[model samples]
Target: MRIAFVHRRGGDDEAVLGQAAALGRAGHDVHLVAADADDLRRTPGYATARRTVTVTTGHGGDPVAALRALRPDVVHVHHVSADPGRSWVADWTGPLVATLHDHHPPCASAGLHRDGRYGGSRGARLPLAWASRGGTADDPLLRRADRLIVLSETSRARYTRAGVAPERLALVPHFVPDGTRGAMRPEPVWVYAGRLAQEQGITELLRRWPAGQRLDVFGGGPRERECRAAAPDSVTFRGVVEHAGLVRRLGRYQGLVLPGRFDDGLPLVYSEALAAGLPVLAFDGSPTARTVRAEGTGTVASWDASLPAALRAASLVFPTLRAHCRARYEETYGETQWVTGTERLYAAVVRAGAREFA
Candidate 1:
């Protein structure tokens, strides 16, 4: 089967590509399309088609043009908010699958971190999130898509609540690559990965970071400078790294510091940390964090009013956290399970003709 995977300018390149890589290796001739060239180059075996469009618009013709040439059996699109690339799905005769990587369609800012959290509060900040956006989910362009791929059951529930046909929704979680690094050192070092974006809660983490333990921050984003300035002397900033480097570099840390107060489905890094046999220090209220705890993967902070104590406790539980983290990674975020679940969704999509059938 021939497949066409389309993603926008920026995102987790390794994760997005890893999701498609298994399909390619399974004998599918995969052609990847992205606004940026670098994002596609990292994924092996993908015939990349670069789309050049500075602004987000429903009319970008690059994706449609690329689809025309590939004659793919399936077109999987990521980050619909950046560029729904609805044009390709609009005219395509094949199945057009849009992955709900973020809550972009109904909410703007893609990640949905509107006024404060990543859930992007509704009301005033909602419109602001979509202000300069070229198009939104309610647009006729997105409504024409053949299917919607959501990474979590919760996200799929949102799509259902938003009136998307139940048949159109499939929960296809992202896959984390195997990161074989040196054994975790016996030390009290905490690490943070992913972009230092607003909703990520990195700024809040740094502001309230405990004084003693070594905190290594790895990632670069709009909030980098502010986070750095506010970080305690114990915090060390390690800018963004390639996928391999990240896993190896982050492995030494006692655990991953993920004080995510926002919701953008799930950060692939959390799973990566777990896959690396490292625990996580996620916020107590996060939906994903709850999932992790329920699965016995990581520990969650219970301090709503006492964050300092929570951080201190997280530091102490580092040993047990690391064990549980690896356990959860294998049981849930493991590559085998991810590939199986994703392949099942792809096959289901291929067999179904319309949303009702899906």
Candidate 2:
């Protein structure tokens, strides 16, 4: 089958590249159509894709024309805008599938975090929800999708409440490549790797980080410098490291600390940590914490007033969770399972679309 995958930019670009490579290896002719060439180059798997195509659509280029010219059997879109007036879905034809990386069509902020938690205090979220309203279960653009892929059950439920048709949603967890599974550090040094934004809870983590354990911070974002300046001497800001190097460093940590106070659908860093046999430290109620508890790969701390106490408590049991963490990775996040499940989804959607057209 000829498949074309599209993404606007960022980490989603790397995810699509991974999918394209896996599908290509499975004997499918896969093509990647993205908006960012620099991001494509940074991703290690992009080189393995059968073909890579970049579109200037976001600026002034015609993505519809590029996609039309390719004529793929299936068009799988990832991380693209869903605003009714700006969406590319209306301009394209064929079996259309979308991976909802976040709550875009429902919540304008996409993080679904507004008033100190997921789905803001009624006052804040109502306006954004009103602006991006998809209009019931029969939303035109969303309904047009043959299938909607999400990273977790948490995401599927949230999108449903936000108005996407439940029938169109499917839960497909994110995948991370196998990493260097080194032994956990004997002394319980921790690491926080990802964007340094407020929604990520970096500020809160730094403020409340237990002085007993040392933390190495990785990745660069808007708040990197501010967080670094305010952080304690025990915290070391390593800045941005390549994906491969980040995973290697993750392997040596006792656990990955994600103090994010928002509703992140599911960040790839969660998968990366587990792949390296590192347990996760996330707040309860967030998708990351839910997955960790469900899989028994880590501990979940309360996001409210008890966070510091929870953090200290999680530190004590971190070593015991290592084996469960790596084993869970093999069962759920391995590349082979991801590829096979995705191939089935693609074929099923294509067949259903063909029947409908006929």
Candidate 3:
């Protein structure tokens, strides 16, 4: 299949690149259409793609003319917000599929965190209310897709409640390449890799950090200084680490700490940790926590006094969970599964012909 992947140049660039690489590996002719030409040539996917095109414009250069020239069998959009005016989806009338990478349209903040809490004013529950408050743009672009790819059941439910048809929504979680390089024994320490922001529950993680427990935090953000000050001596702030470097070092840690308080679908870090045979310690009420509980790949605890005890218990069971974590990643979050599922969706959409919701 000739697949043309479109995305705006931003945060989800790595994920988009990964998907393009996976499809390319599967013997499909994959092309990339990026909104901005800047820094794309340096990315690994830039070289992996059969051909790459950039629409260096504010409103995403004439989508019809650019895409029609490619003559792709399937057009997969990694992020709809890439086009500020969203003219690309409006202009393209083909077998289009889009992945809702974050909580947009309904939750304007995109992370589902606002005002120090998760879920911004019942946006995920009451779409009409959210739309009334000048939040109307992105949802229609999602609904217009031939298939809407959601990362988790949490996301699927949120979009379903927000008026996307159940039939159109496809639950396809993100995948990361396996980074485990052998029988590397893990040290008795926990690792956290993400933005050190309040929304990520970094504040609570530092404030309620348990003594005697060792934690190494990677990545920088707004709360870095505050978190550094508040964190105990046992906690080490490793600053920013590139994704490839972090994944390479993941097998050295006993477990990954996901203290996010919001419903961020399923973070790619979760899959990365699992791929490295590392269990996860996620905070309660998150999609990652739910997966950890269901898969028994790690422990889920609330950010409170009991967190210390929870960590201790998780450590005790960590030895037994390592193999299970790796197995879970292979079964659910591996690239083969993602590519197979994506290919199936693309084939189905192509057969169904070009159809759009009213």
Candidate 4:
């Protein structure tokens, strides 16, 4: 099958390209449409076309003509620029579908989580982000997608409110390959991957962690210096680590500390951690945390006054946490989970001839 994946990126966007690359490796003809090449060179099977504008989510030609040129069996979009009104695919006809990786339509910061918290007033939610050039995702383009895929139930709820019909929302997870999972070997190094954004709450995690607890902070962000300063003497800053480095790094950590206050669907970062056999310590007051909270796979708290105690208890329950995290990964997000869920969605979209309601 010929699948064209589209996303406009000015950053390290392996998450978007990883899906197409994995699909290609799994026997599909995958093509990529994007705004940059620095990141693309590293992604296998990635092919690019020229762009007429910087943020238009459309190809240079007419929407129909552009898609027609690709002749794709499926069009899987991961993002649309803030002006989704300018996105060409909005008018195209091939199995229209996308994964709402973040709250881009309703939130300019895209996390619907800003000022380091989740869910706020419309003004706060819609800051700078517009699904259409002039309109928020409250109408039109959001409703246009045949099916809307979200990473977590928390994201599904937000999208549903953002005007994507609940019927159209599919909770399809991001892919995390077995090769990505690490060998959680020795020591109790708590891991924090992804950008060290305060929205990610890594600063709070370090500040609140008990003294003497060793932590490894990976990924760079605007708050890198602050995170470094707030870190306890036990913490180590490894700077920016790639996907493989992440897995190798996870092997040294007993668990991952992913206390994000943002509604970023399910971060493949956390998914990657679980696959690596590292338990998660997370706090998100939304259904999104269900994956990690289900029956002790890891500890999930509300990030309220009660959170610090929960974190302490979780550290003590390391043996149980270790056992369950691996179990949950095997049962729900292992090799089978990655391939089965994605191919199923692709096949269904192709057969139905439209991205059906999930």
| CA displacement after TM-score superposition, residue 283 of candidate 4 (Å) | 2.6
**Runs off by more than 4 Å, candidate 3:** 48-59, 82-84, 111-138, 354-358
User: Comparing candidate 1 with candidate 3, which one achieves the higher TM-score?
Assistant: 3
| Alpha carbon lDDT at 11, candidate 1 | 48
Indicate which candidate wins on lDDT: 3
Task: Indicate which candidate wins on TM-score.
Answer: 3
Tell me which of candidates 1 and 2 scores higher on lDDT.
Answer: 2
Candidate order by TM-score, decreasing, is 3, 2, 4, 1
lDDT of 1 by residue, 64-102 (tens): 666666666677776534233344455566677777666
Question: What is the Cα-based lDDT of residue 297 in candidate 2?
Answer: 79
Off by over 4 Å in 2: 35-45, 50-69, 82-88, 91-93, 111-140, 181-186, 303-312, 355-358
Candidate order by lDDT, decreasing, is 3, 2, 1, 4
What's model 1's overall lDDT? 0.65
Pairwise lDDT winner, candidates 1 and 3: 3
Encode model 2's per-residue lDDT on 114-150: one tens digit a residue.
2222334667656546646655343444666789988
What is the TM-score of each predicted model, taking all chains together? 0.77, 0.82, 0.87, 0.78
RMSD of 1: 5.8
